[model samples]
Target: MTVKDSCIVEAGTLLVGVGPDGAMERRYDVGIRVHEGLIAQVGAIEAVAYGNDHLPRYGSRGMIAMPGLVNGHHHFGLTPLMMGVPFAPLELWLPRFRAMRQIGNRLDTLYSAIEMLESGTTTVHHIQSGLTGTPDNWHAITSDILGAYDEIGMRAGYSFMMRDQNILAYEDDAKVLAALPEKVRDWLAPKLGAAATPTADYMDFFRAIRSGWAETSPDGVRVNLAPANLHWCSDESLQLMSQTAREAGASIHMHLVETERQAEYALKKFGHTAVQHLQKLECLGPEVTLGHGNWMTPEDLDIIAGCGCTMCHNASSGLRLGSGIAPVNEMRARQIPVALGIDQSNLADDRDMTLEMKLVWALHRETGLFNDRPDAAAVLQMATEHGAKSAGFGGLVGRVEPGLKADIVLMDEKAMARPFVSKRTPVEETVLHRGGRHAIDKVFVGGRLVVDGGKVISIDREAVMAEVAARLEAPETAAEAADWEMVNAMMPHLEAFHRDHPLVGERRPYRFNRITP
Candidate 1:
């Protein structure tokens, strides 16, 4: 039966949490009672339905039930690769990305939601990387993005990236513009000016969006703030973002040290590491989430742990972009919460949290027999609990316990069992290794059956995708073609600007492929 006002979800095996000894804490023959979108009881089916015998029951009789996965860091559903933006280092890729033909907000958001939902992800932290519009424009865009989430029965935390400086490169905008040819410069100036909004206007825009969402949006959607990155935002922008997030009761997510050059840039500009500069600005607190902290130092870890901030690990993005491996094991040792994000750059080029977890599980197995490494439970926790916290849904929808929202995933037990195996293996391990969209039997978000039998029941995935394909099949418009031409014209100047910067040849604390001093 479909989920209604009240329902009972019965699972052959229910995964609750990890124990103190790192073993999976699971129960057999468990039933979860969801009422008014919140979990009311979790125990035997008879106990959960003692007085609610009239309630509908979802028969997950032999399936493995766990908390729905969270994607802590993601952008549009239509990935850059899909838009013809080839993978490059973050520094180089940023400019190339400006040339991608834009997709309609609703279509793009829905496409990603479908991929995440069918693969068992219930929530996503959407950090809008490109901000180019007025408040009125923002209202429509926000509505479309959040509207997509509401239509598909998925949860999302939305934030637009704010940047007031260094739009072209790490150097100042004026300097970069001065070095460019006048013809190219004139073409780029208006484009950049159109995206430029006053610092105060950004705060006002966020306030308006947050207020509107509180009144009309579903409980599953939230509004947060993102300052973009250290190089992109001015000091005033960073401080204001922090203040605005606190006032709005929202969280702040920022990209920091995604590449080694970013670290070197911070050192050259501020005479300190990016983490220290953030602390100096009083932005290193629990309400902040640092994305792709692959170049943080040991001292940075100390500050991050002390401030109780969360770090999102984007393993595949690092590998794909040549960014170094994050110090996830080190963060875990310091009692810092580490979350996993697909970063729209999963190794498979899809939004599969299960596969992301597997890559993380195998990537950080330190040297010898005595080294500390992430086990199955830790990785699962990153995907669920830590991810929930990072996405600004802390203590609300991560666990499948009483008082928590009923966002759950049901995996096919037979698929994981294969054509014969051992019963002694932990359920989390099996799911980590074998579970994926193909193995997801059903998915529920806030007592709503969003996906059933490996298909999203809330929306017509095939039809929507076909429409997107058809819409994209048309040839590029003149504006898009000219944008590509401008990108090509500006590449050499952009390259020279980066190559000749004082910190260009410096080495980060981490290793790289080949660095000639």
Candidate 2:
């Protein structure tokens, strides 16, 4: 297909992110003009291209146009549940991740990317994980992941997972190894061994990636730094990551306290909360995005807001892994930017941002009072504008306005507003409550049609899914099967350790009330 000079997206209802008063606005019978991969004009159809009707027109009547959804944090690989790993708490689940068989990097990336695109997500903050091997090998893997995104025409932010210590346990690898039986210890040594690359070496590789890809990649691709999580990385490693990110003008994303065990570990190891430790290390800044902050306290929220940092709420992942719900309402009340992410753990087991937005809106409605619930507009912002900023694409692709990248989604208004509500019913409200992947008619990234008629145009989705399914069903080696069995056997011991070391501090409770007694 040849690229055109200009195109028009004509919509019956348009939810523009900004209005004449600099607030979110809704317009009717609007046509958006695209030229050179950016929004050229936005107004009534007559004003955009009146007499000259030769330009390619994209949308049709009964179609609604809005900014493409942004997934603030995600792993560009297969979900663990799909790989035969049952959902467990974060600590127990981390070890089992090693036991899962490795599928080809390209296939896994394309598999997840297709799921995201088909669900109307045009931008993603892809946090790379399971990276191993020498520097050249890492480069090859990273390139392959980014190549898939480039071919699929989705905006992406890439960051490699970095960690130096505590591969298996919060206290020390040696301590955990000592507790296991000799046979089990020997079997896990290779899997949970010391870090293969030094902190300095990881920093060097990060610089190499920036020079090799960030400088020359397309308009939507960026490379950033991820220090994995608080328990997984040492203080020195976190400091280096922060320093490198600041020097390179890159962003940082890390998992904060996602579980009660992790919060307890922070108190035991650092004599403070994880958020405070990061603050002391000078890691809190506007460029930093904390992932799955399920255990953030009120003080932590205040500190995060003061530092100008943001949080990526993975509501489904938290629920799947039994991680407590995040204080999203409190975070918002404090004026901290909270974005939404699938984290490869949605209720539907696919990367559906619409469902994610709906889950975020519904999960936090703790009280039945309408006044204390999250409104449709707030959830939409978290999925779009706030998400864009968290993924380092702020002001570039989250809004449907002139001079901004034309990353947008078109939904069938009739399909969304089914059963015939009054004409005065707000389109945004309908979209948030009733919309799903089936309603997404088309998606555009950089003004290019990536999904049309509920199908991705850039790649063969059925073929890719077929290939991945076959690979997943392939016979596993004895060693691979044995590793999974051993990990399964080891879960009891790990659970005992956590049960003994409960959290000890003035921490927020996961639940507010108990059954009436």
Candidate 3:
């Protein structure tokens, strides 16, 4: 089948971008014209001229046109909860993920991509790491991931997760290994047989990916660096990643203080907060985005804001894992750009950015009335503009304007605007309060229709799901079964270790309510 350079037009109530005074502007009966995958014109329908008179037109009525959602931080397309990995702190949960069986890479990626697109997510920052394989193995896996996104027609930023030390605990791996029982230790030997690949090798693989797969497109995929987390990566690894990203003109994303335990680890290991350590390494900049800043202090916020770095708030992930609420309001107060992400752990256990946005909107309203909180517009920006910027697509595909990539979502206005009353509710407010996958009428990326009629258009959803289901039903390998047993035995011991070795410094207030005697 030959792909043609086509033109398309979409007309609806257009929620545009920030105005000169920094307020969101909305216009009714506006039309956007897409030519060769880029937005050509945005204005009154009558004023806009299309190069092709027979081009397709969509969302003529009862629809709202807005920028496509961007998932600022995500992992593989699959969710751990679906595979029997329950909610635990991020540190403990990491091991559980290892025990889960691996399905085909392409199928797993498409599974999440379809869900994301149906929920109006056109772009994602996928943090990939810790896969057990040689460079060739990694190449094949990364190729499969990128291929899936290419077929599904979604933009993605692929960041290879980098870590070198402390694979099991905040302290030395020897200590953690010594603490395990003999049976558990033997079972884990095969899984943890090799030391981490040399940092130079990781850099070489990254260069290979950058040259081969990181092609330039208005709404295509790019590769970035991810230093996994503070406790996982050594200082040398972090420095190498920072320098490589800087030299390559790519972005970096890392987890910082996702939980109180991680905060404690930072103080215990580095003599400072995680954010301060990043600052000390000179890693904070416009191109760096710190994921899950739940335990960031006011001083940390100042440093983040001062450095022009961004933060991604994974609201449902925090709640699901019992991580503390991210201080999004405080970050915004400090003029730090805060974006939204699902982090593969939304309340629904699916990739739904609309629901994630609503959760973010509701999660940070702790202050009394009259205190500034995230309104609908603010949350919308986090899901769209700020999110796009966080994924390294700044000013590229997040707004409905000429010269931007035509990555847009058309929502069913009728579904969102149901139960009509005398006073008309604003479209943005209605979307934030009521919108979900059911309300998504269509999604377009780079002027190509990727989803329509509440279904993804480019791939066979049913076939993908069926294949994955069949693969998952097959019996696990002996290694996998052994790892599962090891995880079960390790959980209690790991929990006890954390409980007994609490932070030495003054601890912060409890993130959630504790049962009192």
Candidate 4:
């Protein structure tokens, strides 16, 4: 099948951008002309295709056209919860992740891609969690994942998470292992050895992936660096990641202060906060994107703002994992760019950016009548423009404007106006308050129709789901059983390590509660 070179996208109402007065700038009955995957012109439908009436068209007079959503910080396709890991605090949940059965890379990635596309997410920053194997194994699995995205036609920013310490807990590996029983320790020590890949290999892996993607899908896919977390990475790893990212002109998305204990770990280990230590290593900068900053202090915020780093807020993940609320309001007040992510743990256990947007809008409201909080427009920005920045796409996407990639979402205006929505209500508010995957009529990435009639057109969704079900239904393999046993054996020791670790520092309260004044 031959692909078209140009097409006309018609919208009943198009979200141009935020206006000077802080309202959504929408144009009625607009048309966008996309050629060679980039928007060539945006104006009246007749005007855009006046001379060339032969161009294929998408959307209609009943759909709302907006920039495709971005998931700034996502881990994997099959969620941990779906794999039988129940929700727990971040510290406790980390250990249980070891028990998750491995689903094939392509199938798992395609599963999440469909979910995201159905929910209007056209781009994602995929921060890969740990994968143990040789460099060749890493390359093969990474390729399979990226190939899935290519098949689904979704833009992606891929980063392999880098860590050389504290693979299972904030405490040192030796200390945690020492605290375990002899039987458990003997079995676990060999397993940990296989998981340890040299830090230099991580750098080489990034370079190899970057070079490969540059030739294949340079604009549609980006390769970046991710130093897993403060407690999980050494000073040398952070510095090397920072320097490598700068030299390569790539983005670095690292997990930082996701929980109160992580913040405390920094203070006890380095006599400073995590953000301060990042500064000390010269890792805090514009090219850096920090995931979760849920436990950041005012000083940390100030430093982050000065360094011009982006923060990807995983609203649902924080609530589900019991990692307290991020200082988004404070970050906004400091004029720092904020992005939204599902973190493979949205409230619905699905990758729906619309629902995630609603959560962000409602979760940060202060108690007082006049207290500042996220508005519909602000939350929309986080899912689009800000998210693009966090994912290293920057100005290439996140706006429905000419000179940008034609990644757009067509919302069913009829569904949005279901029963009755006042014409006075802004499209931003309507989308933020009421929109869901059901409202996503269609999705287009790079001027290609990837989803039509609320279904993916690029691949067979039903077939993929069936394959996944088949794999999941089978009995556990010997390797998987052993891994589960190791996880079960280590859980108590990990819990005790976290509970009794020496990093007991003062944690600032952030979650809403009944007690006040």
Candidate 5:
């Protein structure tokens, strides 16, 4: 593709951004013209049209055109191993992850990417600590995740979790403090082994992986160095990652104080809140997006706004994991771009944005003393534009407009657009109440069809399911539930954490699978 190559695509209801003016409710529909991948024309169907011969057409007669929903924070390869496990809050969820990581590299990557697209998402921001092992053992397996994303025809931002402090949660120091007895030492070896990969080595390891992943799909994937996640990430690692990402022209992602425990940890250890600590380290900026800002104080919210950083609200995960509700209303008031995440393969649940969407409304409605709340349209921005912006796509995506990538989703108009005759037509309300599998008619990534006719078109669904059954199933396929590495190491902590603060599973049986490796 030449730099100046242009293609035209015509669709109904082009939902382009109203520019930097922040007028999201307004849209322009002049059949999109794509030149070198960015949109070139957006207006009436007849005016400023694409060159007919060059622009291959897709007819979205009954579909609505909007920016593809971006998943701002996800652990990319969790799908194949999701079902048949327990939803035991974070503390309980950790040990289970070890058991599930035994699924190995190949199956995990493909399953995660495809499942994401099939469910109507087009871009992903993955907070990757990669598969649980030394990166050398896996050899850019997380990068291979983009292979699946490419095959599925979606855009992605890869953020490798960087940590120097713990050597995987301070495991190195914890390992050789031999004053502890031999029985204890013997027991400690496996846990230490799980965290054994040196942090610096992993950093180089992920950078090389990012390089390779980029080569595989080129423009389809963009990987940024991230602090991985909070709680486990050290101050030095966060600084290094921030510098690396800025120099690389990619954004930095991290889980900043996802829970109350993390908040408490930051206060006691760093003398400031989690956001404040990161601010002091100069880790906040437009190039950074912190996932799960559920425990922010009003002051913390100010810090996020002050730094121009973004927040990803993982609605279901926050509610499920018992992390506090993020102040979406407050963040929006500050003009801080808030985005959405499924937080799936969750050791928790499926990648269902509808569940998350509904929860966003529920939490804010219940909490607000007055009617102050995020309306449907505002949440839509969080899910789409704000998400892409947070993950670094910004104006290049997250909306249908001239000079923007034509990443679009055609929602099922039959169900979602009905009861609509101008006066009753509220696109945002339709999306919130009626949108789901039935409404997700097609999903497009950069003018390519990733989903069509309400199904994923890029991969063989049945074959993928077959692989899931054969490779990821039980009885000799994987390690015994007890024998898994991730589960054993973290199960004790999970159970203990739950002991103090038990999760009330309003929705029971959060699905997960055992990881033997």
Candidate 6:
């Protein structure tokens, strides 16, 4: 229909990342029709557009309408896990991760959801991990987390922590055997179970659980599986996770070349980069999303793009752990899809994506995030459509328009982002570089309000914080506390290991999981 035939819901400005070409348009007097939560009508001032006649209309007011952002890769359990910690590099950080309390239950997950929504991230690809305490426990932990997301009215793609080999990132035998009074080992023995159970059993159990969750709500949760992470998973385990996700019709999220050490191992053991090996294994495709793909060779990036896979970059975690920035600009130049993630910030302590995106600007020159400085709009897209696409929505999300999920955020312009009245200024500049969470007035998903006025509409934030505090105080009781203590206490041993086992000098069959003919 032409503009004359349409009813416009004229807001101050309408930002539409329309079409696969990503043509962005700003129009006034735009009307939208919300039929079953999708924008059924879009046109100029005379046209009627989204939402119900009974609901609040955009009217002539100046609201910068834009698509909601997506967080393509994450580990929700890290919040409580990061309550308090000593700072260290990745090799040292992994050890600390072993002992952090699994304080993130349904409520904590909801709290994290609140923070993301407040920041305008409506969709999240939750790459959960460190959940293996006992049988059915893993399912319980993940399901509880997703339940919070559903109740909070956020859209999420849930990838489970599928580690066939390491149920828990257990301490090495030397460390455990030395410190574990036989009493502690015996106490944990029954829970550990026999070591020889087929890995498929774990896969089957989680798949059944995923199917059940999908059958139940299906809207809020996208349950997929992947190995716990590269360092934490074996080659067979990675292939099995990939195969399982394929059979289950679910997406995958795995850590690839996250650190210098991990990259070093792939070269030494596998005779190729981890990404190259996985590519050889036929695992790089739309069905897979690689989280924290740092240290990739030019060839590795090409393979990822050729397969139409996504590289979910975690900017916060990289800086905190001293891992180099992802070559985002290289991927963009090659037309590879890139998405944003928070990574282990709950412990390492950076959850805000606004800061994360800016980091792209600060270090892009070094990492080749862009040949020229990336424009604000480009960085915003990485946080939104690029992120949504990585989560498998492609063009269906990360934008405000017809035929897309109405994952949206309304910014309180009256707050910090002042003088937004100019018709010439781009909204991307305001949202990406200026507006902060305090400016978030409302957040929506599928046309549903999840967070309003910077507060969660569903859960009690105060109560959630209380539970988090309680869990944080007693990280010692849980297995996580023990693990962190063990890892840190043995820093000397790990340091010694690092001297010989430098992260740079490694590549083994397990590390380089390729399906040889």
What TM-score fits each model? 0.95, 0.94, 0.94, 0.96, 0.83, 0.84
**Model number with the top lDDT:** 4
Candidates' RMSD to native: 2.6, 2.8, 2.9, 2.2, 6.1, 6.2
Deviation from native of the Cα of residue 26 in model 6, angstroms: 2.9
> Residue 426 in candidate 1 has what lDDT?
78
Error of 3 at 460 (Å): 0.8
Tens digit of per-residue lDDT, candidate 3, span 139-200: 88888888888888889888877777778777677677777888877766666655468887
Please, what is the whole-model Cα lDDT of each candidate in the order they appear? 0.86, 0.82, 0.81, 0.87, 0.65, 0.65
Best model number under TM-score? 4
Candidate 4 per-residue lDDT, tens place, 198-298, comes to 88888988898899899888788899999999998989988988999999999999999888778788888899989999998889999998998988888
Q: Which stretches of candidate 2 lie over 4 Å from their true place?
A: 1-5, 18-23, 368-372, 500-509, 512-517
What's the residue-level lDDT of 262 in candidate 2?
80
lDDT accuracy of residue 212 in candidate 4: 83
Give residue 8's error in model 6 in angstroms: 11
> Clashing residue pairs in candidate 1, if any?
none
Compose the digit string of candidate 2's lDDT tens values, residues 315-358.
99888888878888878778788889899669988899998898
By summed lDDT, the worst window of 10 consecutive residues in model 2 runs over: 508-517
Lowest summed lDDT over 10 consecutive residues: which window, candidate 1? Answer: 508-517
TM-score of 2: 0.94
Model 2 clash pairs? Answer: none
Better-scoring candidate (TM-score), 3 or 4:
4
Please give the TM-score that candidate 1 achieves against the real structure: 0.95
lDDT of 1 by residue, 324-393 (tens): 7888888898989988899976998899898899999998886689878898889998999888988888
Score residue 391 of candidate 1 by CA lDDT: 84
Local accuracy of candidate 5 as per-residue lDDT tens digits, 1-517: 1122355655555555435645455443446666666666766666645245656565444556777778888875654335445655464454454445345545665666666676667888866654447655556566456556666667888766654443322233453334344543465556656654555666676578667765765666677766755556767767777776677677777877676556666776777788888888888888888887766777888888988888888877766666556767777778888889887643236665655676776666643367557767677777788888777677667877676776777776676656764536565666776777667777767776667777787778668767776765556533354445434554455344344443232432321100000
Which model, 2 or 5, shows the larger lDDT? 2
Candidate 3 TM-score versus the reference: 0.94
Q: Cα miss at 93, model 2 (Å)? A: 1.5
